[model samples]
Target: MRKIAFIAFGIALWIFLTPTLEIEVLLTALIASYVAARLVGNVKLRPMKILNFTVLLAYNFLVAVWQSLKIVLGLFDYESKYFEEPAGRDFLEKFEKIVLITLTPFTIVVDEKENVLIIHELKRRKGTE
Candidate 1:
């Protein structure tokens, strides 16, 4: 019964994902279904948890794509600001660098001795803060 359910679910998933199907698609889906069922049979999943996780994943994906589009559209909105860094905040600086690298093509470094941060932006858009 469980095996039949897995095979049916796999076929449905393959049909939904592929625009056009072929003999190869059926063969691949059959094998994949068998393997996936064997691998995950021991694990139990809740539908609500899966739904929540899927929604979160979709939301994050859209946000990331939107950010990338804004960057491409030259919406480099920012403001020149200065702040006093707390002493022994190396971890904060490293985290900031990691975030900037992931979200933008920008390089930032903190000069602890001088208590200054140097931000190098790849491009600047006019009239952006």
Candidate 2:
């Protein structure tokens, strides 16, 4: 059943994503989001809800790529003495902040179907709290 698949997937993810483990959080996020979009594709939402989810996913994907590029460029230039310089550190820190923000929408998009049940109180636990 779907529940079994979801549970197995979640356990597998957690095992691989152990706190100190070498898992790629971004990859896990993308997989979860794709699962969500499929689940919602079965829902009977208004046109706007479908559009909202699509736009959020698209933007989140774009931002993730952009942040990754910046992160890579940052690491490449990290040897510059500028690391000790306030401006350089500040730029790196700000870039990190942006990456964190980029993760938020992606996380929310992971539960693409949950948005349709926000008004319910069924105590169903979704991806994020």
Best model per TM-score: 1
| Candidates' RMSD to native | 11.2, 18.2
TM-score of 2: 0.29
Clashing residue pairs in candidate 1, if any?
A: 78-129
lDDT (tens digit, per residue) of candidate 1 on 2-91? 666766666766665576789898888889988987876754444564455445544554566786787799875754433333333454
Lowest lDDT block of 10, candidate 1:
79-88
Cα lDDT over the full model 1: 0.56
Give the alpha carbon lDDT tens digit for every residue of 18-125 in model 2. 455444654564567557546634433344643454455456666766756865686322211111112113333433333333353222111112122111111213
> Where in model 2 is the C-alpha error above 4 Å?
1-42, 75-129
Best by lDDT: 1
Clash statistics: count for each candidate: 1, 0
